[model samples]
Target: MASIAIAQTQQAQATTSAPSAAAAAAPAMQLEPTSVIVLDSGGGSIKAGWAHDSQPTIMGNCITRPRSARRTFVGNELDQWGDLSGLYYGYPTQKGFIVNWELQNKIWDHVLSSSVLEVNNFAETSLVLTEPLFNFPAIQSAMREVAFEEHGFQSLLHTTAPELSAYQQRVDSPSAQEAQVVVDSGFSSTYVVPFVQGQMLPSCATRIDVGGKVLTNYLKDVLSYRQINLMEETHVVNEMKEKACYVATDLQHELEKAKQRPSSNTISVDYVLPDYTTIMKGFVRAPVARTGPANMSSDEQLVKLNNERFSVPELLFHPSDVGIKQTGIPELIGLVVESLEEAAQYYAYQNVVLTGGNARFSGFQARM
Candidate 1:
């Protein structure tokens, strides 16, 4: 868990003379929570909305150019495209860090100026932006320039995602302990962070290279080798991973079940691939008894999944399987706790928090 700190910076105007009596009598302006925009910028998606909203609006963080279309789509515009095959994607961030400001500036322009966020005036709105832990100084500087100079925001408060998570935990459970450990498994990597009494310990934090993007790419490779050649279909394969994959509590037992015949294998299932005509997105075709002749009228494509479902997600627990030489999330969390003080270790272990997109896996909590 990381500590949350809100520090707003505003530009000061240079005045040569004293203020007028009428100006001095007027009250100073203040930013309300409803007028502030909260943006959680991630490698895979951007979670943005007003501070007063109950939920954040999620938008894809990458720009895509479809093979069928000549023009490119930015952020949420990809949803309007019907054909999703062979989309060449351009990302503003790489490995969880902002490197391409040119592309990111475009995304920000679209997000702030377009109807997505409905920001009427950038100069009047204060922004609460989140960046990754140990972010580059150059990137941070660029972000400040973008917010104040490029977008002309009235004020900006920079923070990290884990910090916000810790703050939310305190708000939700005020009677809970003071120490917390946050495991943020996102697109580029996973981070294990510790916070004690609302203060983050940067030295004790650890990171793993495995994340949702690696798992999705691994699944694509396995599917391509076993089924049709889907090397270019990243968009489709990502959806497949979300719809079909899950963590396994008993890895060896599940592997054994997958080894059985298809008729008797309980772990095996058929994932119907999208044809972009009848089915816009793929679905898991329910297992049916083959007691009669097969229906010849339907021409749907399918990929048979057995061990790949659980094996892909297993990389989070064992990055060694993919030759990453780093410890998994569980070991990483333990290492962070061991590095902390004895008094904080107990509370950190007791109040562990799991966040990010990967935490939504079907059996993730059970596996943990």
Candidate 2:
């Protein structure tokens, strides 16, 4: 989780230079914690809440139109729509960068005006918004204009999410060394960022093109080829991936185990497909003894999963499996650590941190 901190400036600049001794000694501007709002926007979701709150309110970062209804829903509004199957999704971000401001603006308006954040007057609230690392200067300028001119915020602080994560670590462990490496795997891509003395080394940062979005799409394609066609059911497929998929600690061992007969294979299981009426979301069916098809219900649809559960997540470890031509995350982290100064390498390796939605995969830490 990212940490919230108050800045002395109204419009905080992204800089690497340290403050002068006199400036550092001066008292900083104070603001009530309740008056500040922290918004951590990412390609997959947007996390927002008051600065004093322990947890941020998370919501999807897209606008959707359900197949059953003609009305469109923004952000968290999709929860109200019972039928999530075959929903049409419009995302404001692509490859971890915001590209469609028109769609993004609508989602932002809904989040700020609705009960999620409930900002009655932007002028009275200070905004602490997070942006992607290595963001374009034009996008940064546009964000400032939107915050000050469009939203009329009294003050604004722009920072990256990884920086906040590193800051939080420092706060949690004050005795720990300052050198650390943050592995951020999100919707569109994964980044290995190294921070030294609370500052990031942008030139040494590495990026991998695979993330949760790619994994979900890969699972969709594989399932479509093997069983039912789920080309338009991206939402349903994503839910299924989250509930069933897991990282493999030993790829070869797991593969050999998965090749066994379904009756004896521990990795093999059936995923119950949602019918929208009885089940809103798909679930992993409990293991059952069956000799033939007669034991299964005719009305229920089950997708038999075996090697796919581990093979899909394997792409993160070896993109070459899909011909992406990039090194896996573990090797990339090693390369990043070696590229740093000799003195910082040891501490960086010792303080490595895994974050983002994709990091929640089972056995992810063990695999790393």
Candidate 3:
């Protein structure tokens, strides 16, 4: 949390510093028509900031009850806790949709009122929040009431996450100069929304019921069945997946290599579980030669991994691997575009952009 604050401070250091001769000589900066406070929250995370900023300040969007900590932690406060074993999480959204506004409102209050964001007067800022592609009418109505009557914002522009991603795609992909297909696979689900000149085509947008949570759970089940039981270690399992999992370009070929003779396999690795007394967190350790227990170099327990690494992430491309009938990530995008006008389809196909946390998985774009 301190690091995040420091980073944001550093980002504005130049503008906040004493005015120089160059600064005095330069023309006064002009504000946008709307002094927008862009906030986008999902089931598990929140990305928010002033519209003028280059990037957003992201923080956990859920409240958690960890066995190690006595008091419940909410939002960024979760980062301050230690010994996060056996954490049972409570979220505002279920199955990618917000189901509990009380929790949602509490989190939003923390976000808007906390010193982290420092928005003095909500009435002075134009609020822009991102909603799910298929938002419930009740959720939408409640959100507007909170934004206007409760918080008293000057203005509000509530929309979908894909719309924000698509706008960002335009800014980042200057060469594209056309419509785009935004592939956002976050914690709860995957959404495919097309943007034509920064406007979303809601009629053609589609969503897939798969995401990081499902992927992680699927991986855990496979590992538990074949390697070890991790059913009670959700916290550790999630960390292991983030630190070690990667989307492989060649699924069948990699699986074959994984099953080959030990010397011929490149995918196999040893993940060193952290010794809480010395090291606070677990990590993927460099390959160590397997030997008797007495001959081990470190006390950290090492778990041998092979096919699990490649097979888990493969679920995104082949949901059928987990018996999910939904289409793959790329196929979902193709499904949305094929419904568009003939001319628009070409631009949408060429300018596809992936967003959300799962998009960070290595070789994900390559697989797409």
Candidate 4:
């Protein structure tokens, strides 16, 4: 599971770097050339644009939470007050739902009015924004209000991020019988979606409270346990995970190697922090060092790559370890298949398809 996520992350990076490639490959997905805008606003970031395109046209997190409303974007310009403050500083749909009308209004205002976008003529734009699966009706109503009334957006198509991504993947796949599962590992949670014959099985869908943010926090805790004072070093820790972390195929065997003396098989890392050239790159010494705390001595410590961080994320597979009584994924899949009463037409064993950001994880493919 971790491997696939890493691959997806790398692919996302590649897509961002190569816009022309994305644009050229857009038509293969059979998406309508209606200036389609697919928007995904999670708890951590926002991804917005056409579904067929290789990437979002504009990708930027609404960083308003960390800044005051008066903080002007146009140079530290003076003469800022209340009403203008709210207008200038774009709003965000924090806590993973678009509940506040004012914030949604601000978001629409920013997206439409930004100098980078000339989308004032909303009728020409086929807008697609993300919404949670079990989204509250009030929030849905508010979003509709914002689209039609506030933004004058006539063609609004709201879908969940996972669902739309699933749609794209399903459409892209070779045949309709390719049974695939869509796992979305986002900011606040992870969703495992089962698709058979291009349709999603809602009851079989499962969620885990694990994500990049959760893994980051877990790594933070492990480093803290090692007495690493990282009150201001969150970014460094994140970089380390991105560079060095990997899930062990055989946990016990890897743990044994990590138990060996540092000179033998252990990973020795030299985190060269912050000279500010693309964030400090962490290097793992070829001939491992016999240094640092005794607690960091075990092979298990280094073998897992993420230490407890990897295990904590793995808890999604074994929720019982974390006190969640829900069945793990394989069992869940079986249950889901059983529950699909219309299974005569579809073969769960043969046509299983797995696609999604989270579905890219290392062990995910094999496990499914």
Q: Pick the TM-score winner.
A: 2
Model 1: worst 10 consecutive residues (lDDT sum): 9-18
Report the C-alpha lDDT of model 1 over 211-327, residue by residue, as the tens digit: 889998999898888878888999888888988888998989999998886668887777878878778888875443222226322677878777888999999999999899999
Q: What is the TM-score of each candidate against the true structure?
A: 0.89, 0.90, 0.85, 0.69
Q: Could you give candidate 3's per-residue lDDT for residues 1-368 as a string of tens digits?
A: 00000011111111211111122212212325235566778766887666667556777778988787778887877778767777778889998788888998888888887646777877777676778887888988998999999899876667666655554445456633466777778888887777776567788887777888898788778778877777767768878888888999888788788887665567777787665666678877545543335645566677777877877778888888788998998778778878988877777777887777788778887777
Q: Model 4, stretches more than 4 Å misplaced?
A: 1-34, 57-60, 64-95, 99-118, 174-179, 231-233, 266-270, 275-309, 320-326, 342-346, 349-368
Summed backbone clashes in each candidate are 2, 0, 0, 16
Instruction: Identify the runs in model 2 with alpha carbons over 4 angstroms from their true place.
Output: 1-29, 287-296
Instruction: Evaluate residue 120 in candidate 1 and report its C-alpha lDDT on the 0 to 100 scale.
Output: 85
- Between the candidate structures 2 and 4, which one is better when assessed by lDDT? 2
lDDT of 4: 0.50
Residue pairs in collision within model 3: none
Provide the overall lDDT of each model, using Cα atoms, as 2-decimal numbers. 0.76, 0.77, 0.71, 0.50
Name the weakest run of 10 consecutive residues (lDDT summed) in model 4: 75-84
Which sequence of candidate numbers ranks them by TM-score, best first?
A: 2, 1, 3, 4
User: In candidate 4, what are the lDDT values of residues 1-368, reduced to their tens digit?
Assistant: 22221224212222221222223334323435445555555655555544445655443334332123535442112123222211222335444666455655555455555443457567656556667666788987877787787667656655565455544444444443355555566655666666665566677777766655556666667666765554444445655555555555566766677666555655344443333333323444333354535434232223223245245456546657656666665566566556665652255434344433444445555654
